[model samples]
Target chain A: MKKVIGLWFALVAVALIGMSAVQTEPGLAVGDTAPDFTLRNIDGKMVSLADFPDAKGFIVTFTCNTCPYAVMYEDRLIELHQKMAAKGYPVIAIQPNDPEVQPGDSFEKMQERAKEKGFPFAYLLDEGQEIYPAYGASRTPHVFLLDKSRKVRYIGAIDDNPQDETGVTRRYVEEAVAAMEAGNEPELTFTKAIGCTIKTKKKG
Target chain B: MLKKAIRILGVVGALSLSTFLAAQEEGTPFPFTVYETYADFAPVMAQDNDTTYVINFWATWCKPCVEELPYFDSLHVNVAQKPVKVLLVSLDFRRDLTRKLVPFLAEHPLKPPVAVLLDGKYNDWIDKVSTEWDGAIPATVVYQGGKRIFHGEQFSSYSELTDLLAELKQ
Candidate 1:
C-alpha cells in the first residue's frame, strides 16, 4: 500500500511540472525570424505584420503607457513611425505586458496614451504573449527591426540614450532602417536594452 | 548682519545633514553586517542550504524596478513563511550608495532582505546572474530548491508571484 501511494504522488508531481513549461518562454537570441502575429489597435482594428508588405522594414517595439523609459521614446517612435511609414517603413508598437497584472499597462491605458500622442502606427496587444517570446521581449521599449524580406536585422535598445536623446551616440533602430534602405547590413545591430521589466500573469 | 546670516545658514545645513544620516541609520530593517566583496557571499550559495534567494539587480533610476517594489515587498513577506529569502542587490552607482541609493530605498521604506552590489566591474557579475540578460533593469533570479530561475520581467499579477514560488518549490 505504501509503494502504491508513493507512485501516485510522483505522478501528480510530474503532471504539475508539465503544466509550467506550457506557460511562458522568455529570452530570444540574434538571427531569430520575426514571429508574425495579429493584435488589436487602439481603434479596435486587427493589425498584423502582413499589413506592412510594401515597407522596406518594420520596427516591432514592445512598450507601454507608464514606463518612463517608454514614455521618453514615445515621441521619437511616433515621429519615426510617421516619417518612415511614408518611406515604406512603419513601426508596429505592441504592449506585451499583461493588463490584468499591471494596472498601468491596461489596453485602455495603452489606447489612451497612443491616442494622446497621436501615434501613427498600430499599438497592438500581444495577448497570451503569442508574440513576446518570438521577439524575446524582456523590457518595456525593447525594439526589433526587420528588413524588407521580413528577417530580423536589429534587436535591442531603441537608442543609446533612454533618458536624454540629446546625448545619444548611437541610433540602433534608425541605423538599421538606413542600412536596409541602402541595401546594406546594419553595422551595429544590438544593445543592452534597459527599461521596465515586462509584466506577466501570476500563477494561481 | 550678512556674516550672521551666513553663520545661521551653515548651522541649519549641518543640522539637517545630521538628521538625514540619523534617519538612514534607523531605516535598516536587517541587522548590519559588512562585506567588502561578492566572494564573501559565495560560500552561502555554494553551501546550497535550504535557503531560497531572489537576487535582483536594479539601478537607482530604473522605472520598472520602482514599479515592482510593492510586488517584491509582498514576495518578501510571503516567502518569509518558508526558508526563502529575497536579496535586493542594487546595481546603482556605487558612489551613490549612501547619498542616493540607501537614502532612496530608505525614503521608499524598503523592508529588510536587501543589499547593494558594490562591485565596480558590472560586466563580470552581470553574466553570472543570467546569460540571456542584455543588462536590463528589473532582472531577477530565484534560487530555490537547488535550482535558479532567471526572470527578466516585472511580474505584476498575483499568478506570477505564485508561479515563481511554485517554480521554486519544485
Candidate 2:
C-alpha cells in the first residue's frame, strides 16, 4: 500500500510539471534579445539581421499572403519601409506560414506578391517553421520592433485601426521607431490586433 | 385583345412578386448583427446568467476558424435541452458583410446566432474577453455563472468541444 501511494504521488507530480511546461511556453517578451536568423528572401537570397550593420533597429514583421489582416497591411508595410528605411530602421517582412498548410504563402507566391507590390524591404520565408516560434509570433502581421542591440522594444500591431487606413488613430510601429530615434523607450511597448493565426502542421 | 393583354400583365406581375419574395428569403443577410465597437458588444461577453455561454471569435478568412465552425453548431444542437448558448462572433471586416461574410454564410449556413464584431481596437478588448487570449482567431470562451474557460486553439472535433463543455459543467 505504501509503495502504491508513492507511485500515485509520483504520477501526480509528473502531470503537474508537464502542465506547467505547456503553460509557460510563451514567445519572447520586451527586453528579451531578438534571436538573429538567416532566412530565404523573395529574391532567392539569404538575408539576416547581421547584414544590416549600420541599421539603428529593425521592424520585423511576421506576415503571409493569405491572411486578410496581412493583406490589409501590405501597402502600409511598403509605405512603412519606404519611409523608415532611410531613417536607419528597415522593415524585415517574414512569411511565417507553412507552405504545405497554406499554399498561397508558398515561396513562389511570396515572390510573386513581392514583385507585384514592388516591396522595398526583404520579404523572407521562415523555412522549416523555425523562427516565428522562437520570436513567439502567434499571428500574421505581428510586429516585433528591435533596437540597435537587437533587444525587442515593441511588439504587436502596426496601428490602431486595421479595417480602414484613414481611420487609424495610433501608428504603433512608427511611434516605436521614433521613440528609439529620440533615445527613449517606446511609450506603448505592446499592443494587440485581431489577426489570422499563424499556420502550422498539426503535431502527431 | 385589350382584355387578353391585361390578363398577361397581371400574370407577369404575380410571377415577379413571387420571385422577389423568394430572393428576399434566400438572401436575408444570415441574421448577423454588426457591432462597431467592443464596448457595444461587451454585454454579450459579460452576461450574468446561469446559462453556459460558448462564445467563439472567428472570421471568414481564418481557415481554422471556418473549419471548426460546424463543431460549435454541433455543440449547440447537442446541448439544446441544456441551459447553454453558442454565439459566433465574427471578426470579419465590416466592409466584407456584403461581399464575403454574407456569401460565406449563405454557402455554409451555421445553426447558431452569428454576430459580427467589427471593432478594430483589438488591444483594448482582447484582455477583457480573456487575458489568456493573444488576439488570435478560433479562440473560444466558455462561461457559466462566474466560472469561465478560454481556449486559444481550434477544436479538432465535435467531441473535443463537447468535452470542454462537460469540463465546464463540472
Candidate 3:
C-alpha cells in the first residue's frame, strides 16, 4: 500500500513540474503594445507581426491542427481570415501547441494543412512558444487583434459560440474589426476562448 | 446482418469502455489527499500548522489540467521533504465519482490525496476560490503562511513548480 501511494505521488509530482515549466509572462491586454516575433510560415517565408504594420488591424489566432474544436472551426477560420483580409485586416494563425508532443501538429503537417486548405493567411509556428504569452493565449483558436498603432484593441474568443454557429450570441472578432473600421473602441474587449488548451511540448 | 451490427456495436462499446476506464485509473497519483468539498478547502488550508499547500482544482475533461497532472504528482513526491502537502481537487461531477473518477485514479495510480468536489454551483464557489477567476479550467493556488497566490490556466514545467515552491518557502 505504501509503495502504491509512493508511485502515485511520483506521477502527480511529474505532472505538476511539467505544468510549471511554461513561463507565462501574463498577457497583453487592451492598450498594451503588441509583441513582435519572427516565425516561419507554411511556405517557408519569413513572417513577422511587424510585417503587418500600416494595415488597419490584424487578427492573430493561436490555432493547431488536431483539436476537435480547432478542426471544427477550420472553415470559419478560413472565412474569418479571408473576410478580414479583404478589408485590409489580415489574419495570422499561430500554432503555439508543441508539435513534438502532438505529432499531428508538426510544422510539416501544418504545411500540408496549409496546402490542402489553401490557407488564406500565414500559418506560423510559435517555436518555443515565446510570443503566445504576450497575447495570453492558453488555448488553440484564441484570438488577439492589434490596431494600426500595434496596440491591442481587442482580445478573446474567435466567436461567441463554438458548437453551434447558429447560436453565436457575440461576434467578438468580427465586431472588433467592425469597430475599428467605424472608428470606435470595441464594445467588448475580451472573453475566455472556447477551445483546446495549448499542449506545450514536454521538456527533458 | 444482425450479427454484423452487433459486432460493430460491440467493437465500439469495447473501445469506449477502455477509454472510459483509462481516464478513471489515472485520477489520483500523489501522496497528499485531495478533498473535493469547497467548504473544506479554506478550512484545510487554515488547519495545516506548519505545511505549505499546492492546491490544484481540475477536471478530466479539461485538457491542460490533465496534461499538467503528472507534474503535480511528482511535486507531491519530491517535495514531501519540504513536507509540503499537495492536494488535487477534481472538479468532475459527483456522478462520475465511483464509475469514472475512482476507476481512472486507480488506473493512473495517483499517490496524492484526492477529493471529489461536490459543489455544483460555480457561482457560489467561484468567488470563494478567487474573485479574479472567470470560471476557467486548470486553476491552481499555492498557499503558505495563510497567504494565497492564485494561478489560472495550464502550467507545464518542473522549474515553474519549483520556483513557486521556493518563493513560498521563503
Using TM-score, give the best candidate's number. 2
| Cα lDDT listed for each candidate | 0.72, 0.89, 0.75
- The estimated TM-scores of all candidates read 0.62, 0.87, 0.58
Q: Which parts of model 1 are misplaced by more than 4 Å?
A: A1-29, B1-18, B21-55, B59-104, B108-130, B140-170
- Please write out the lDDT profile of model 3 over residues B1-170, one tens digit for every residue: 99999897777766655665564477633222345556766575555566788878876666677778998989988987885888887776545566666556645656677766654434446667766655556887888766777887677587787678777767
Give fnat of each prediction, in order.
0.45, 0.82, 0.03
**Candidate 1 local lDDT, B31-149, one digit each (tens):** 22333455665543444777877777666677667777777778777767788776676655444566776556545656656665554333334565567676667787877546878
- Can you tell me the CAPRI class of model 2? medium
CA shift of B124, model 1, Å:
11
Superposed Cα RMSD, model 2: 7.8
lDDT of 3 by residue, A175-196 (tens): 9899888989999887664356
Residue A135, model 3: lDDT of 77
Candidate 2 residue pairs in backbone clash: none
Highest-DockQ candidate: 2
Residues A1-204 of candidate 2: C-alpha lDDT, one tens digit per residue = 999999999999999999979877767899999999999999899999999999999999999999988999999999999999999899999999999999999999999999898999999999998999999999988999998889999999999988899999899999989988888989999998788899899977
How should the candidates be ordered by lDDT, best one leading? Answer: 2, 3, 1
Candidate 2 chain A weakest lDDT stretch, 10 residues:
A19-28
lDDT of 1 by residue, A1-204 (tens): 999999999999999998877756655555566767888888899997887768777888898887766888998898888777887878889998888877888888988887788888889888887788777777788888886666888887777665566767777788878887888878877666556777776556
